[model samples]
Target: MSAPKQDAWVGHLGPAGFDLRSDTMTTPTASMLAAIQSCSLLDDVFVEDPTTIELESHVAELAGKEAALLVLSGTMGNQLALRSLLTQPPYSVLCDHRAHIIKYEAGGFVHSFCLS
Candidate 1:
């Protein structure tokens, strides 16, 4: 078989380059790296990061929501969505068997949100 294609942006095919289990395995492009280099380093918890606040606000406006939150990972995003929508108990989320949340989140919905 041919060798894995090298990533032009990062200069190497990282460990997840050949793995297709998740989209997070992909490498960032040069533009993405440039953006990260200029991103604010302030703490986001205190809402002091201009970049984070600007991104969140832009996303919220685009989504027609009053506000939005920036989560560190997909797991946190999924859990927050579940917690917000499934406020009452007896919650049941429908998803494909191979969905990442069901397969990789270690039952975060059940443990963190107490979904049935």
Candidate 2:
């Protein structure tokens, strides 16, 4: 048996791919590249970046939420949400067997929230 060649799965490349190896493997659209190029680079935490604020607001409106936060990755967002909800003494989490929160985050729950 031989490994599959690039052409065998060329169509599966970029955002079209179902591959979960890494998000970096996905290609960005020209519009997205343009937007990023023109975007104001700022420390979103300390300084209020207009672009980020606008994006957050837009996302919030679409999701019918009071507000929205943009994190670096899905894992970070999930961890933050869990931390906010499990503020009590007995901090624990319930997740499915294949949940990415446990499997991919370097035991973030154990370190951040003290979850077993």
Best candidate according to TM-score: 2
Stretches of candidate 1 exceeding 4 Å from the true structure:
1-25
Q: What lDDT is reached at residue 70 by model 1? A: 87
By summed lDDT, the worst window of 10 consecutive residues in model 1 runs over 16-25
- Residue pairs with backbone overlap in model 1: none
Error of 2 at 91 (Å): 2.1
TM-score for candidate 1? 0.70
lDDT of 1 by residue, 1-116 (tens): 77867774434475754543345656677788899898879988888999989999999999999999988777888888888898776788899999978999999888996545
* C-alpha RMSD of each candidate structure in angstroms: 6.0, 5.8
Best by lDDT: 1
lDDT on C-alpha atoms for all candidate structures: 0.80, 0.76
